[model samples]
Target: MSADIEVVPSTNRKNAFRRRGLLAAAVAVAVLARVFMFDHQSLDYIAFIKRWYDFIAANGGFGALKHSFSDYNVPYLYLLAALTHTPIPVLAGVKIISVAFDLVLAFFVYRIVALRRPGGWLPPVAALVVLLLPTVATNSALWGQADAIYAAFSLGGIYFVLRRRPWLACVFFGLALAFKLQAVFVFPLLLVLALRKWLPWRALPVVPAVVLLLDVPALLAGAPLKQLLSIYVQQAGSYQALSLRAPSIYQFFPAGADAAVIRPIGVAVTGLVVLGLVAAVVLRRATLNPARIVLMATVSAILVPFLLPSMHERYFYLGEVLTVVAACYLPRRLWYVPVLVQGAVFPAYLDVLFPKGMGKGGQPGMIIGQAPPGGVATPPPGGGRGPVIMGGGPGTSMYEPTLEYRILAALMALAVISVLCTAWREFRRS
Candidate 1:
């Protein structure tokens, strides 16, 4: 088909085009990474960087790592301690860590997609699409958040589980939960797998063991065993709001909603939805295929964030990657899935970075707390204008992003339903 040569090139024009596209995507990632690398955008970088660095400087960095009370667990804190002593600007260093994982997350996503949708441009293109998602980019590079860290491991765990590597999958899941509690987004799916007999219950013990493994260093240090064990339990009590300003069903309630009542109400509703899903999985146990199970996991990832009692806007980050897996697996006509999922997430980032400065309770100066030797001696971060957005007026609060988030939440709910229906249909076909 070549105009200048009688014989075709060893690599056809189509193959050449695909290679060119992949190269272009790689270039785009590099340029974007550089842009994010230097942007100095978030308060999280300022606040946590100093707190962590000071923790290292306060006593011995190793002692700080052993004590473990940074709201995040040992795995992340250990890395922070190491970086604290490094010469790199703490903000840039952490953001770089986040950004680098963003690509690893992209790689795992590509592997998941390629496992099912092999050939042509789908895998690479899908990975680029994920890397470029506004929420994904903003959460790591701009907001300096670590959702991607958990997401990468969770996705890999799911992938490995499907590949029949149960112990590896368990370890990956444990790694995810160790990074962040939101990693529970995929926790329910593991439950579904255990019920489906894809994973043996005997192998399930590996999860807790791995979690203990992550905590071993802290325990070995003088860190109270009670503190290490109750880390998540106490974190759950830190915010009592029905929504904690999450983009979900709770957003439909009146702006002045009461947590005492609304919390129980939300739980009751979420419980019913989860029960419905679990029932569906049980009914389809015999027919369960990897794609269907993936769809179920995607459903749980979205549903937990959507229906749960005390979710934050970023809690649903798992859906972003899991849907990609499901899309490529079913290769279903569901392009809108990721679109709807991320709609609320990026807006919440804007809400925090408001020009007015984190809107109320937003304190001034670097924060060091839980009052350790290095603590600037400020009180422990007492949910003050906590980076965790508390309840707000509909459009009435000085920080008026609530109304925008409410509208987006409703649309995201619809998006959840649409994807579920599409995946359910595919499950039946499977």
Candidate 2:
């Protein structure tokens, strides 16, 4: 019997060691993949980020924050300012910042998975899956977008919320909101928790407080207080299009459809969806569980971006990650959610990264085609060259919903419905 116990201990040690080895190998592979992708200079980099970096460098690092140089929030601008002081190439430094958060995002995934499904290979595998996700990889390393930074904090918020740490959840979520307004995609999930009493209502103030608190540095550096607070407001009014290549309900409308009429309708529809989610939580608070929380988060992440106008293609980043976490939580039933979400979002990234100007034979550029009536492309904000239309002149509308985006919209709509039905069934069961 003693020998039997000794053998069991030895086997467990070997298994633990093996899991560690696998995780390390996965991390190394993920890092090397990002290294190869560091060379791609995305339009965002060339047009906006690089210029912003140079401006900060020329104007004396953090002191440059006082001027309205970029439309992005102060938190990210802080990163750009700090990058100016570093010797690393601006492109690589920006991508590296995102990659670091990509790992943090993956660690949170691992933690969330291990929280519910402990003592197994599934947790590390989930982390590996996140690091290797196509959008996650490209958003950071290839395109040099900071979606992962906000995404990492958002996931950290979700993990803490699941662990019943409401204050920490708010802090992390505040950090996310500080990075991007798109972080509001997950706000409804937090509201659901608050309504269900999983998180205390008072702790909610921590979110905006944290956002404001982080602005102190920029404020001290002479950045206008009002401007820092209203950055998101400016961002909201910056783009007039119904969709910025986002695979949303706007895709179902004609490219020439009047934005004035459609924009309000989209907002109203998104509001209704959010209200419906809140109602579900109120009606079935007892049914709330860790898996269900993830499912509802997945729903918010998908439905908000899918229904709202003025959304960018990468707005669905959280949805893609949450679907994976949802699948890990209930692999047998929800395993396909991640696949569908990724399918719906990944092509949009490809379309943006390799626009029509890049020439064909590689990634598709369905986002930029068929300029509006004027056939002129308006320069993107922050003073970069406007999107190049193959045959059209500048100052024209550069965005027209292509068949590919329409299909993506439909797929996302289907995902939203499928997840909603599943959530309803689970709530009813409880």
Q: Output the number of the TM-score-best candidate.
A: 2
> Model 1: which ten-residue window has the lowest total lDDT?
390-399
TM-score of 2: 0.92
lDDT of each: 0.71, 0.84
- Check candidate 1 and list the clashing pairs: none
User: Candidate 2 lDDT, tens digit per residue, 1-430?
Assistant: 9999999999999999998998898899999999999999887777678878998999999999999878888899999888888899898999999999999999999999998889898899898999999999999999999999999999999999999999999999999999999999989988888888899999999999999999999999999999898888878877767888777888898867888888888899889979987886788655677988888888889889988998888988998898888888878777887787788888888987886653233333322322346664334553322344433333345566778889988888877887888777777787
Predict model 1's lDDT versus the native.
Answer: 0.71
Clashing pairs in 2: 376-395, 376-396, 377-394, 377-395, 377-396
Backbone N/Cα/C clashes per model: 0, 5
Tens-digit lDDT track of model 1 for 252-311: 777667768878777788778787777776776547666776787888888788888777
Error of 1 at 316 (Å): 1.6
